[model samples]
Target chain A: MSITSLPETDRSVPLNRNRRSALIALAGLLVAEVVLGSIWKILPQNSAVSPNVFTALMFLMVPPILFFIYDAIWGIKSRNSKMASYPMMLIALGVFVLGTLWTVMFSFTNIKIIPLFTPADWVKGFVGLANYKRLFNTSRWMDCPGLTKAFQSGWEFKCAGALPNMVTYAVLSIAISVSLGFLLAVMMDQKIRAEGVFRTIFLYPFALSFVVTGHVWAWIMSPEYGLQHSIRALGWESFSFDWIANRDMVMYAIVIAGIWQGTGFVMALMLAGLRGIDDEIWKAAKVDGIPAWRTYIQIVLPMMKPVLVTTFVIVSSGAVRIYDLVVATTDGGPGISSDVPTRYIYQNFSANLGQSLSASTVMLVAMAVVLIPWIRVEFGKKSQA
Target chain B: MANTSTISAEPSGAKPKPFITWERAVVYTVLIVCALFFLLPLYIMIITSLKSISEIQGGNIFVPSSNPSLAAWEKAWNSACTGLYCEGIKVGFWNSIKITVPSTIVSIAVASISGYSLANWPFKFSEGFFTILLLGSFIPYVVMLYPIVIITRYLGIFSTLPAVVLVHTIFGLPIQTLLFRNYFASLPQELFKAARVDGASYWQIFFRVFVPMSVPIFTVSVILQVTGIWNDFLFGVIYAGPTNYPMTVQLNNIVNSAQGGKAYNVDMAATILTGLVPLTIYFISGKYFVRGIAAGAVKG
Candidate 1:
C-alpha cells in the first residue's frame, strides 16, 4: 500500500536477477529487430508487400521494446508484494495494444479496410517518401511558372506552399497570443475591482468550442455585412476592413480570431502564475523604489519561468492543431491562402490518401519537435527535484 | 499596499488626496476597453439572434433591437435545416449527450484506474510507456483519423457513437491518466501503506482509499472531460455518421452550408446554441474550470 509500510527485509531484496534477465531479453529483441529490419531494407526496390509490412510492424514495436529495456533498469516495485508485477505487465500490454500500436501502424501505412472481406488492399506497398514528396511538392516547384518572379520578389504569403503557410500561421499566432495574454495578465494582476467579472469575460471564449468562435469571427470579419459595414454606416463612407477577403492578409485575419479565442485561456494561466508570486516581492520592490513595470520585467517575470513554459506549450500546441477555427472562418478560401496543415489533410485525405498521409506524417514530425523537448524538460526536472 | 484605496489614494503623508487621478482613469479605461473587446462577439451574437432578419440586414449592430424576438432561437433549435434535415441542432443534441456522457464516463474510469495503477504499482518500464503515451498525445488527431476510421470499420463500430466514444477514450487517455496519476501520487504514502498492511488488494485500495479521498481532482477531471467530449467536432463529424452527428458538427453544417439564402439570425442562434453547454459548464463550475485548466497545464 505504501512505501514506508514495506517490510524491511522484503524491501532490501535485490532485483539483480530480474534486472539481468530483462536486460538480456531486451538486448536480444533489439538485435533481432535491427537485423531483420536491415535484411528487409536490402530487398529489391520493387519487392512485394510482405517485407514492407514486416518493417512497418517492426517499427511499431520499437517503442514498446525500448520501454522493456527501460523497465529492465528500473525494477518493478509494489507495496510489500511481488504479485503486483503480473497485473502491471498485463495492463501495460493492454495499453500497448489499445493506444500505441494502432497509431504507429496508421502513421506509417495507407490501409483501406473497405470491401470487408478482401485482404488484398489491406497492406499497400511501401511508397516511402513518395507521399511526403507530394505534400511538399518537392519536384513541382522546378516547373512553377512564376518561380523566378517569386524568387525575385521574396517569399510572399503562401509563396512556398501550404506547409510554409502553416508554419508561419503557427509562429505568428503563438507569438501574438502569448504576448497579448501576458500583457492582459499583468493588467489583471493590478488587483483591480471586479476582477472576477473581468476574468470570466476573458475566459468565456475559451470555454466555447472553436466552431462557435470561428463562425462568430467569420461574421465579424466579413467585409460586406460585418464590422466594416456597420462602421461604414456610421458615416465613415471610405472605411474598409477586408482582410478576410484579401488573400495576402487573410492569415492575419485568422490569427486575430485565434488570438481572441485563445488569449483568454492564456490570461487565466498567466493570472494564476501571477497570483502564485509572493506578495513580499512587490513590497520589497516598492521599498527599493523600483518601478512596477521594472519589478514585473526584471524581478517577477523571471521568477515565473515554469508558468511561462507551460503557457507557451499550451498556446503553441493549440496553434499546431488549429483546424476548427480555420474551417469555420475561412475554410481555406480566397484560393487557399489561409489553408493550414490540418485543413489540408482533411480536404485531401479521401481524394489524395497518400499525400494526406504524408502531410500527417509531416505533422507528426512537427509535433515531435514541439512536444519532445517539453516532455524532457518537464519530466527531467521532476526526477531531479 | 492596502493604504492606497482606489488608484486615486495619494501616498500617505504626501499632499492632498484627489478624488480621481490620471492613473485611475487609465486603469479603468484599459480594463473596460479589454472587457468590451472580449464581450463584443457575444453582444453581436445575442443582438443578431434576437433581431429580425431585416433588422439585422439594416445594420445597426450595436443598437438594441426595437422588437427583440426568439424566432431565430426557436428556428435554430427546432426547425433550421442541417444538411438534408430541416430539424435543427435539436436532432444532434441527444446525439451529443449520448456521445459525451458515455465517453466521459468510460474515459475517466479508465484514466482513474490506470492512474492508480501507475502511481501505486510502479512496474518495470512504466515510465517508458508513460512517456510514449504522453508523446502520443501530441500527435495531431488528423494523423490518426483515417487509421481510426479503418480500425473502427474493421471492428464494425464505424459510424456509431461507440466509435466516437472509443476514439475519444483512446485520444483522451494520456491527459486523463496523467491527471489521475498525479492526483493519486500526491496522496500520503502512509495511507497506502496502512491499506496494504491491512490486506487491501489493489482494486480494494483504489476503490476504498483512493477514490473517496480524490473527489476534488475527480470533479476537475469531470468538468474537463465533459466539456472536451461535448465540444469535440472532428471525431463527431467523421466517426458519427449523418444520423448521429453531434451538435457542433450539425451546427457547423447548418450555419456554414452553402445552400439557401444566408439566414444570419438563424446562424447566430445556432452558434449560440452549440456554445451554450460549455458556457454553462464554465459559469457553473466557476473556479473548478480554472483549476482544471491550471491542473491540465502545469506538471508537478
Candidate 2:
C-alpha cells in the first residue's frame, strides 16, 4: 500500500498496522491458487476447455491478481488505508485496461488469425502506418473514370472516401444545428403566449432516439410519398424534394434531419443560459435604446459563451459517433455517397480489422484534438481550486 | 433548478399582452410556423399509421383519412415480420425488457455506489481514475467496441443478452456516475458526518440514509438509463445477437429490410411503438429530462 495521504481527520487511524496480516493473507491466497491448480490438473481429463469454465476462471483470477499485485507493490509497504476506494479502483482499472487500453493496442497490430472466434489460433504482427495509408489513400476511388462526368458537371470531384464525407457531415451539421438552434433559442426567449406548448413541440424530438428521428424524417423526405408528393397533389406539379434519393443531395437531407433532432437540444441549453442572465441586463439594454436583435447578437450571446461551448461539445460529439441515423435514413445509399467515418469503421471491421482501427483512430484523434484543451482547462480549474 | 422559477414566471408575466398587437401577432405566427414544422412529421406518422394502404398510396399524404383504421398498429404490434419472425416487434419486446430492466438497475446501482464513493471517500488515486473514466465517456464507442467484443468473447458472453447488459453498464457508467456524483456532492455534508458519528457503516448509511434522500436523483438516473438502454441500437445490434435483439434493433430490421415489399403504415406504427417508451418518459418527466441534460452537459 502506498502512503495514503489522508486528510487531518483521518490521520489518527494508523493504517499500516495491518501490513503484516495482509502479507500473510497474500501468501495464503497464493497457496490456495496453487492447490486449485493442482486439483484442476488432476481432475480435468477433457481435451477441450469449456468456454464457461474459462470465463469462470477469468472472473476468479482477476480480483486475486489485482489484489496480489497491489499488495506486493503498494499495499504491504505503504502507510495509507484506501480500502474503501479499492472497489472503484478495481473497476476503473479493469475497464481502462480491458476496454480501452487493449483496443488502442490492437489499432497498430495486424492479426492474421482472429483469436476471439477461434481461440487456439495465434497470429499477430505489427504493421506501422500500412493501415493508415489504406484509410487516407482516396486515390483508389478518385482515379475512377466515372467521376470525370461528375467533374465536368461543376461538382468538385475529389476523393469519394468516408473521411471526406464524415468531415462534410460534421461541419455542415454542427454549423446548421448550432446557428439554427441559437435562432430558435432567441425566438423562444421572447415572452410569448403558448410558450410551453411551443417549447415542447420544438424540443420533443430531442427525446426520441436517432433511430426514430431518422425513420420519421426518411418518410417525410421520401420523394414519392412525402412532403413533395403531398405538395404536388395540391396543384404545384414541379415540386421536387427528392433529397433522400439524390446522391448529391442526400448529405444535405441528413443534415436537415440532424439539425431537426439536435437544434432542440441546443436551443434548450441556450434558453437555459438566456434565462440565467439577470433581468437588469435586459433593462439596461432597453434603457440604452439597443435593438432586441442587437442585444442578443452583441450582449447576450457573448455572455453565454460557456453555454455555447457546452452545446458545441455535445453536438459535435454526437456528430462524431453518428451511425444509427445514417443507417436508418440513407444507409450510405446511391453508392456510398453519404458514408461517415463511424459507418466506415463498422463496415471495415468485418472485412479488414486494420482498416477499421485506422478509421476509428482518425475519429479518436479528431475528437481529442477538439476536447483535450477544454479538458485541460476543466480539470486544471478543479485542481487549482 | 436555477431556471425553473424563471421559466414559470415568463408565461404569467406575458399573460396580459395586448390581444391584437402586430409584434405579438408576428411572434405567434413565427412560433406557430415553427411548431408546425416540428410537428408535421409526427402528424404524418400518426395519420398515415391510421390510414388504409390505399389511402396512403393514392390520397394526399398529409391529409387525415376519412376512415381511420387501427389495422396497421395491430399488425405492427402483433404480426409484423421481423426477419424470420412473423410476430412483429412484440417478438423482441420481452427480449428488450429482459435486457433493459437489469441493465438499468445494475448500471444505476453501480454508478450510484461509485458516485457516492468518489464524492464521500477521497483517496489517493480515486480522483485520477474518475477523471480518466469521465474522459473515457467522450471517446467514441467504436474505438472500444472491437476490444469489448474480444473480451466478452474470451469470457464467452458474446452474442448474448448478458453481454449487451454488460456493455450498457460499462458505457452508461460515465454519465450516470457524473450525475449521481454531482447530485451527492451538492448534498449537505453534515448529514454524512452525522451518519458517520452514529457508527453507520458505509453500505448502511448509503442504504438507510442517502438512498432515501436520493430518490429524486435516482428517478432522474432511472429515467436516463431506462430510455437509453431501451432505445439503444448499435450495442444491441452488435453484442446482442439475433435471438436477443432489442426493440430498436428489431424495428430497424423490420423497417429497413430491403427484401420484402415496404409496408409504410406498419413501418411507421412499429417505429412509433419502438419509440413510445422513451417518448413517454420525455413527455411525462419533461422538466427532469431537461434537468438531466443540463446536469450532464455542464458536468461533461
Candidate 3:
C-alpha cells in the first residue's frame, strides 16, 4: 500500500523518514550506475574488462540491496511490495544490455576464435579499421555479378560473399513480400466465403520456424525427387526446375521460400491495417461515385502508411536476420552464394572473432538506420497526439 | 481485411450478394490458387513424411503414397541420425519442451512484473529504463551474440540448457514487457485507485483484480512467446550447443547433415515433428495468434 494509504498513526514521521532515505539511497545507486556506464564507454577499446570491478560495484550496492530486500519483506507483511520489481528492471538493464554494448566495443578489436574481452588477452588487440578493410576487400564479401559489388572493380570482386547476397535477399524479399501480402490482403478483404479457412491456410507457414520452412522448401525445390521429378513423371519428361541447386538461381529459391513464409504475416498485418480504416472513408468514396478499385488504390492505400511502415520494418528485419532459413535450406552452399549478413556473422563467429564482430557491427548500423526513421514516425506521432 | 465492400456503396446488411460476377469468380480463383500455394508445402511435408523410401523414390511428389506407413515417422522419432547420433529427434523434442516451458514461464513472469511496475509505479527513471528495453527489443540478436556467449561462458552456463533459457528470457523481455505494460497502462486507473483506497498492496491488487481482468492480454502474451520461443533456431544452435540442441536445430542437422545417403522421408518426418508444436498452437489459438501478431507488430 502507498504511504498515503497508511493510517495516520501507522504512517509516522519515522516511516516517512525511512521512505525518504530509501528513495535517496536509490537515487545514489542510479547515479553510481550512470558513472559506471560512462566509465565503461571510455575504457580503451582493447583493454580487458575485469569481472572484479563488477564485483566491487555489486559490493557497493549491498546496503541498498539489503534495505530493499528488507523493505520488500516488510512489504509482504503489510502489503507494500511495489519495489519487488525494481531489481528485476535493473537486471533487465544489466542482462539485456551488457552483451550488446560489449559486442559493439569488441567490434574494433582483432580477436580470433577466442574472445579478447578478458584481462589476460588484452594485449595489442585494437585495430581500428583493419577488420572492416579486410571485410570489404575480401572478394567473397565484395563480389556479386549484377548488384552493388558488380559495379566495383572486377578484378577485386571475385567471390560473391555474404554481403552482396544479403543485400539481394533483403531487397528482393522485402519488395516481394510486401506487394504479395498487400495483394492477398486485398483479395481476402473481399469477404469471400470460408474466410477463416482461407486466412488459416494463408498464415500457417508463419507459425513454423525458419528451419522448418527452409527444409520443406528445400525438398520442394530439390531437383532429383522433388517438383522436377513430379512434373516429368506427369509425362512432361522435360522439367528442369533446379533453382535450389543452381548458384545463379539458388538465392531466388531462397527468396521464394522467404516470401512464402513471411508474406502471410505481411498480409495479416495489411489486413489489420485495412480493417482499421474508418468505414466512413469507404462510404465517403462511394458517395462520391468512385469505383471500388480506385477507392482502394487512391484512398485506402495512402491511409495505410502506418501499417505499411510497420510491415516494412517487420519484413525487412526478418529478411536481414535470415540465417536459419539459409542454414536449414542451402547451408549457404555453392560457395556461400545464398549467404545473408546474419548468417555470415554467425559462421565467422566460430572462425574469426574480429570478422564476425565487424559484420555484426555493420548489421547493427543497418538496424539503426532502419529503426530510427520508424521510431520517429511511430513514437513521434504518439507523443504529438 | 480491406472492407472494400465499397463496390456496391450499400451500407451493412442491405448490400446484396452479386450474382456470379467475373470479379467475384476471379477473387475466389486467386484465393483458391493462393491457398494451394500456401498449403502445398505443408501438404507435401505430411505426404512425404508418411511415404516410405521406395514410394518417395518412385516419383510424383504431389501424389500421396499408396502404401503409407509409420516407418518413416517411427524412424524419425526413434532412429533418425544427425551425424553420429541416431537417437532420432525425440531428444530434441523433449529438449525443446524443456526450453520452451521454462523460458515462456520465466520470461513472462519477469517481464510482466517489471511491466506492471513500469505501468503503475511511475518511478523517476521508468521511461529511461523502458527506452533501454525498447531499444533492446530492436537490436538484432546477431549483434548481441558474441557478448552473450561471453557472458554465458562467464556464468559457466554456456552450451547448457539454463544458458539457452537465460538467453531466451533476456531477448523475450523487451517485447513481453512492452505487451504487458501497454496492456496494464490501458486499464482504467479507477480500479487501481479503488484498491489503493482499500489499502491493498501491489501484489494483492495485481492478483485479486488485475489478474482476473487480464485474461486476453495474458493469452496474447503466451501465444506470442510460445510461438516465438518454439521457433527459435539461433539460440538453440548456439547456447543449447550440441548436447542440448532443440528440435529446430536438430531438424536442421538431420536434414542438412552430410553423412550417409540422404533420408528424405525421415528428414521430412522430423521437419513435420519439429513444426507440429507451433502449428498446433497456431490452429488452436487462432484469434489470439492474430491479435498477438498485430500487437507485436505495433509494439514500439
Candidate 4:
C-alpha cells in the first residue's frame, strides 16, 4: 500500500475506533447531565450534591457540548475528518458554564444555606422582573419624602435617584473623553519634533491605575487646599470652582478626573492606528500633491476604521464599568451625582441583598447592550475575512 | 527611495528656504502649551507633597513657596492617622509589594502558557476555547466580584492576602492572555515548526525557543501587569484583610473617611507614594513601551 493512502483494514480500524470513542464520550456526557439534573431535583435543596460532583458534571457537560457544536460547524465547511482536541477546550467551556451557573444559583442563596449546600427557599421564589423593575422605577424610592423633595429641589433634599445619576455621568464622560482623545491623538501625530515625548506624556496616566491618579486629581481639584484656593492666593479676589461640592457639576468634576486617566487609553489606540499606516502611502500621497491635512482626513482615517471601532468599544466598556476611580475620588458623592453603574451595583450588593440582584440584572443588561453589537461585528468581520 | 530622491531634488531646486517657519514655530508653541497643560497635575502633586498642611490650606498652589517643607512627606510616610492607627501609608507598602509581586508573576505565567497554547499549538478546540476566554475578558471584573468573593469565602481564604492575589490574577488573565496570544501569533510560525521537526516536546519548545524570544513582550507584560496589580484598590479593600491593605486602600482611608477632616497635603503625599512603584517602572521601561507596541504585543 502507498504511504499516502492507508491500507483499507488500517483505515477502517482507526475510523471505527474513533467513532466508537466519540459516541461513548457523548453518551457519558448525557448520562452525567441527567444524573446531575435528577440529583438537583431530588437532593433536598442541595444537601446531597457534593461540590466536586458539581465541578465534575460541569467539566463533562461543557467540553462535549462545546466540541460537538464546534465539530458540527467544522464538518459543514471542511472535508478534513479529524476528532476535535478535547482537554483544554473542555476545561475552558466548563469554567464558563459552571461559573455562570454558580453565579446565577449563588445569587439566590443566602450565607447559611451556601455553606451547607442546602437550597434556600428564596431559590424557588420567582421575583421575575421585580428586581429589574425596582432598579429603574423612580417611584419605589420616590415614595420617601426626603428623596422626592431632594430630586425636585436643590441639594437641600437628599432624594437620591439611583439610575439617573449614573446614566448621566456615563453619557457625559464617554462623549467628552472619546472626542478629546481623538483630537489629542490627531494633534500629537503631526510631523513635529518631540512628538514622541508628547505621546509618552499623554499615555503615562494610563499606566497608573485610576485609584492613584484619582487621588492626585482630587487633591488638585479640592477647593480648600488645592488649585481653587491656590488661584485665590494669586491676587484674585474671587476664584471659586467648587464643582467637587456642587451637586450639579460634581459629575463633571468626576469626568474631568476620568478624562485625565482615560484619554490616554483612547490616544494610545488612535496612535497605534496612525503608526500602522504604510510609509509608502504617505509618499504616494505626496507625489500626488495631496496636502497632508486632506490626505489624513480622506485617506488615512478610512483605513483606521477598525482601530476607531476598537477604541470606541474599549472606551465605552470602560465607561460603563467605571467604579474604582469614582469610589476613590468622589465616593459617589457630592451627594451621589458621580454615581456610575458599577458603583451602583457595588453599593447595592454590599448594602442590601435584595437590591443587589436587581442592580446586577441592570448591569448585565447594560453590558449586553454594549457588548452584543461589538461582538457581532467582530465575529462578522472574522467570518468574512 | 524614489520619493526621498524627489523630495531632495525639489527642495534643492526650490529657493533655499529656512527649515523653521512661522507656522512651525506656532505648532511648537502650541505643542509646548499642551505639554504644560498635561504636566500641571504632576506639578501640583509634587509641590503639594512637599508643602505643609498649613501652606496647602493657606492656598499657594500656583507657586512653590520660598519655604517648601517635607513635613507632609514625613506625615505621609510615618505619622498620618488613618483610623485609630497613626501609622502612615508606609505600613501597607510591604503588603502591597508582596501582593503585587506574586499576583503579577502567577497571572503572567498562566496567561503566557494559555496564550501560547491557543496561538501556536492548534489543539482541536483551541479557537472555541480562546473565544470563551476572550469573552470572559469583556465581562466586567466587578460582576465577578460577588461570585469570586463567595467562592473564596467558601474556600476559607476570603479577606486574606492570598484572596486578593488570586482575585488580581483572575481579573488580569483576560488582557494578559490577549496581549501574549496576539504577540505569539505575530511571531514567525517557522520557529514552532522547526522545533516540532527537531522532536522537541511541547514544554521544551516553550521553554527554549519561545521563552527566549519573548523578552521584549515580557517587559511590556511586566509593565502592564505591575501597574495593574500594584494599583488595584477594590480587590485590596474587599479581599485583603485590614492588616494587609495596600497603599491605595490606605490612601483612600486618609482621603475618604466619613467624618474626619480631609488632609489635602497628607493625601497628596500618600497618593504620590502609592503611585511611585508603577511610575518608576514606566520611566525605567519607557524604551520598551514603544517598541513593544510597535511589535503589536499590546492591541490598545
Best by DockQ: 3
Which lDDT tens digits does candidate 1 get at residues A1-385?
1111112222122233357656776788788788877786777876633464556557656765765666676754352222333233333344433333444444345532222213343255444555555555642211233654675656542353466667777898888878888988888776566777887998899999888998998888888678888899999999989999998788788888888888888888787777777778988998899999899999989988778876777677778888888888887778777777887777765666656666676777777688655666566655574
Tens-place lDDT per residue, model 4, B1-300, is 012112223322235657898866766776677667677888888887787656666657867856887788888899877787888888878888889899989888877877776566544445666677666666665656776667677556778878887787777766677677776776777787778678765578778999999987888888777887887877888899899998888888767752456667777788888888888887787656544433331253
- Per-candidate DockQ values are 0.31, 0.46, 0.48, 0.27
On lDDT, the stronger of 3 and 4 is 3
Clashing pairs in model 1? Answer: A1-B192, A1-B193, A2-B193, A71-B125
For candidate 3, write residues B229-296 as lDDT tens digits: 98999999989979889999889888867466678899999999999999999999888888788775
Rank candidates, TM-score, best first: 2, 3, 1, 4
Higher-lDDT candidate of 1 and 4: 1
- The residue ranges of model 1 lying beyond 4 angstroms of the native Cα positions read A1-124, A138-161, A382-385, B1-21
Q: Candidate 3 — which residues are off by over 4 angstroms?
A: A1-82, A85-88, A118-124, A144-159, A382-385, B1-15
Candidate 2's C-alpha runs over 4 A off are A1-91, A96-98, A112-124, A138-159, A287-289, A380-385, B5-7, B10-21, B258-260
lDDT of 2 at B281: 92
In model 1, the Cα lDDT at residue B285 comes to 84
Recovered native contacts in candidate 2, as a fraction?
A: 0.47
**TM-score between model 4 and native:** 0.80
Write down the RMSD of all candidates, one decimal each.
9.4, 5.2, 7.6, 8.8
The candidate scoring highest on lDDT is 3
In the range B34-142, model 2's lDDT, one tens digit per residue, is: 7888898789889989988788778888899899999999999898887777888897778889999999998898888888876676556666877777777778889
Clash number for candidate 1: 4
Share of the reference A-B contacts seen in candidate 4: 0.34
